[model samples]
Target chain A: MTVFRTLAIAGLLLGYAAVTSAQSAVDEIAKYRQQLQDGNPADLWEARGEDVWKQKRGPKGVSLERCDLGLGPGVVTGAYAQLPRYFSDADRVMDLETRLVHCMVTLQGMSLADATKRPFGSGTNRSDFEALAAWITAESRGTKMNVSISHPKEAQAYRLGEKMFYFRGGPHDFACATCHGESGKRIRLQDLPNLTEKAGAQLGYTTWPAYRVSQGELRTFQWRLYDCFRQQRFPELKFTSEASIALTTFLAYNANGAAFNAPAIKR
Target chain B: MTQPRPLLLVLLFVLGGCATPTELDIAKQAHEVMRASFKETGQATLDRLNQDLAQSACSIPPSTSVNKEIAATIEKENMASIRYPADGKLLGDWKSGERIAQSGVGKQFSDDPKNASGGNCYACHQMSKQEISFGTIGPSLLGFGKLRGNSEAIQRYTYGKIWNAQAYSACSNMPRFGHNGILTEAQIKDLTALLLDPASPVNQ
Candidate 1:
């Protein structure tokens, strides 16, 4: 009886120690994120992005300065907060990257291939889209997100996105909800938020276009969805595709009242 | 991409109406959009969008239940497909099973098709007292073998459940591992041992 009691006490202490160590590891990752706030590598991308916005280099020798980001012609302040909206000119809903590509094709007379060749960056082969998204999304910092479902196409996209969130297929029989439908669930040590709920949706949506320290790249919302699809073991989501915009529309619209804050740093 | 199907035109025609549409009506449209939205890359093809009856049935809004008949049909069809090992050995090396459970690789468009897939068990369940990093989507399997004695019936249930989880419970979040060829029979046996073997950390 004495030996059994002693062993039980030891086991309890061991379990308690394991829980605290795991917690401290999570807290440390959070601390790492806070430390990265002051000198965000995303700022470097933003600086280059602003330059790309003003430079005249395409076939038409025009700058993206004239592109209307759904706010008005060349009206960029807080524009990212209202995006994944319907544009009459295109007659389809578009996310910021799709709209940016549209401007490159229409306003600058650049080939679609040239414009989207590097939607994401890799070693020394930087993406113009990343640079541009960084600057444009930065312009929306401190602004409240007010994405609208007023437009019929926007409404359709939002609804379709909602379906995609719950859609299950592929080899693993996984949905986005498989990982994110409930609060406080995680995959290994990484925290997976409940994107189905309001607070999680808002938090997940507003913090994209983040500079990932692991990959050393500023990933956009399109990239986030694209990678998510990849991880979900689905086929590659086409860059700037209607499906991408639709999913983005669902998330961005769900994040209605949260302040738009990104091109932020992340681990 | 091919032209939008006649069904899409029908959907567009309906959306053109004044009445609000049900999610079921829009589900067809969503599937169509997904089919068109993805491009084949690496081993991931457009076929991944193809939904089996169980997948489609389970994808509905959480508030609704798949009608009883359909749920029973899914479970029956899946149960019919379970294949036991030829040698009748359900357990393998639990140490190897632990390694397989730790890995989350394979089948993504970015993952090499040649590489073996991992059960990614640690991503969802607490398997050991030492590994604190586990997801809560599924129940904790710590002390799983300790709770259930290693009878032949218990071993068979563990092996078969890991092989095709959907067979026992239709619309379960657990994958149809053997059915989908995500893990080989050998890997399944290892996973079974990991859950049922007396020496396995999961039982400790």
Candidate 2:
């Protein structure tokens, strides 16, 4: 009887120690992260990005300062968090960068083809766009994401985006859902966020225009989408295509209440 | 039959020596073949074929368990390579970061050589709720700031992980951004804000 009692006590002690150790391990990781946060490297991009925003260029020799970001003409503050909204002039929902392109072409007299064809952050045109997008997004740093889908077009785009997200047809027989639709999934060591959830939506949607340490260059949202198709072995998604816009609307709507953040850094 | 015993033994020995290829050997061969088959084109050059230690390690078959000692060594080596910003700032313009992450241009065979590279983060991560088109290789970073809070430590982790994912995870498939020079420091800062800033869409 004594031997059995002693065995039970030992088992209980082992279980307690195991649980405590697991919790402590998690805490240790968190603490380690904290220690490293004193200096972040992303400030350099932000500074240059701001400079690029105000510089004047293009055929008309005008800057994007006078451009309207839907809030008002020449107003850039707090515009990013409320993007993919309805635009009466364009008669469609427009995100920040696309709308900027329209402004640069129309207001600044820059050719549409020149503006669109320039690769991201390549020539003066693309650089201007990146800087403008960066500065404007920074202005709305604390704002919540509120993409309006009140318009019929907005609703249609959202639905289309949803369909696209789930549509599966590629060489690998992969769909976005195959990787992101589930919770607690990971590729190697990277954690896979569940896009269907609120927290996941916020985490997934708001961080972009990020720096890629691997490529040694800044990237835009359009490029990000295009790469997804590439990895999926699917046909490329044209820059700022209807499919792209619709998908943006869907994600924005899903992240209605989440805060906005962009131009982030990544490995 | 007794006289043939030696011959039977020799036949058994020969049969035993013919073993199947080990998983590691098979992986190595496949990697070598893949490296040899591709040629450089435009910005996408043959140099991209080279695999870092992390990639090479991951190419091997996954057994029931990973040797903890090797994993630790990989992580330590990668961690030692992480470079923090010269100045002490992690946050940047979320707007610009958004564009960078969204773009999938540059570094392709057909791409213009003059153009700058893009992060293509959306291809692997869901960043903003407003942007619907994104990939799923990595996790959704939306509300990252909100959940974890924009503490200094979280910012550091974000920067370090993005700079060299292998530092955090020995065999992570995620690319080493800083180690490979894939993005500039400014771009990294902007992306950091996108993930950790309270006002950014990710935190929303």
Candidate 3:
């Protein structure tokens, strides 16, 4: 009788294990799609961003509505796809955020220091920047990235960014290569994209200005670079510094031809 | 006869020493090896070689479980370190917060020491939906505001959690944003707004 009881228990345990294993697989797939379906919270920021763009309030009493995003002045439709391009006015290459800062300062009469100090989504002051960026990025949701690296400065920034990507340091002797240079690498269950590759670069770079669920916040490319430094145990990245801009140029150039899906939702 | 006994005892002692190293001994050896492999540089002193209590505790092999009391103590200690904004305000501009969260710069040997640090929250958690590219070390935070309305309690919790994640979860891999001074109070407030603001992308 005891032998029979043990056999029954063992059989039950085996059956339970099989069922749970199958269930877990199904659950994982469902979770992946569910994450996709949630449709990123950045949409909310995009909505508010539209309002901020049209609202006229700076010292110049002008809205960003008349600002050009590469296509033409006041034409935001599909403009993000062709950003980090040469702007004749600035006489230099500028990404979306940098261009927006210029507009906020020049057109709005806001001080560059005050505008930069506020950060992306903090205070009523910088909130407009986030909203504007979100709205502008959304207009080009389906457009492909076409960053111009032909210019000397653009090319220089790209090369500098490449150098920065491989540079190693910190107590752990880690580099960006430690986490993202190689394909098929992951920490825990998450996969790390190989930013060096075209597909990886496209997937990684084109999907910035994302909303993070864990932190419950919106993040821009500049912030993304800043965080990478922190994890590497590096000192700190200044806001919109040259290094930051250079890295953006490198990533943007690599993401050429990929769809612009900024202000994305992330897990 | 006495000499033979002593010789046999010595042999046994040597044999016992040959046994595999204990966990503690292995850890010590590993630490020593790491120390030998790295050299100190500017601002990033050798002290960083030493793991804090939380890091040390978490470093233990998975085969062993942390004692509940120790885990609770660590959590309590980390929680105590969290500091709220000087003003009662918890939320700031989600737009600026987004920049801080997305930034993965700061705290590198190559970086200028004078610059401020960043939170790099996206490295672990998925806060926004629009950013197709993100890591998943922690849970996804899409629709965080939609699910949990921006209540005062939730705002405080978000601030506290970002300030010191260990306060909420004992051995969380998340960094201590406020505790480490990686982010300022204003930065934390912006992050909070990014997370909880109805108008922020995270909520949408």
TM-score, B chain, candidate 1?
0.87
The residue-by-residue lDDT of candidate 2 on B55-155, one tens digit each, is 33333223112245556766898899888998999888988877888776654556675876677787767777765445556778877888888788999
Off by over 4 Å in 1: A1-20, B1-22
lDDT of 3 at A155: 72
Best by lDDT: 1
Give the clash count for each candidate. 0, 92, 61
lDDT of each: 0.84, 0.63, 0.68
Model 1, C-alpha of A260: deviation from truth (Å): 0.9
- Which tens-of-lDDT digit does each residue in B1-204 have in candidate 3? 011133332332344343233433434444443344334555655455455555454443220144465567668888888887777999999999999988866656655668876677776676766654456556789888889898899999999988888788765656677776667899999999998998988877
TM-score of each prediction: 0.90, 0.51, 0.53
lDDT of 1 by residue, B1-204 (tens): 122245543443354343245756677788888888899999998888877766776785551255565667678888888899999999999999999999999899998988999999998898998887777778989999999999999998898888888788877888888988899999999999999889999988
Q: Write the per-residue lDDT of candidate 1 for residues A1-267, one digit (tens) a residue.
A: 234334444544454464555676566555555666766778889999999999997999989999999999899899999998899999999999999999999999999999888889986899999999999999999899999999999999999998999898898888888887878887776788788888998889888899887677889999999998898999999898878888899989989899988988765
Query: Candidate 1, after superposition: displacement of residue B11 in Å?
Result: 19
Quality of model 2 by C-alpha lDDT: 0.63
Per-candidate iRMS values, in order, are: 2.5, 14.8, 13.0
**Model 3: runs farther than 4 Å from truth?**
A1-30, A122-126, B1-204
DockQ of each: 0.56, 0.02, 0.05
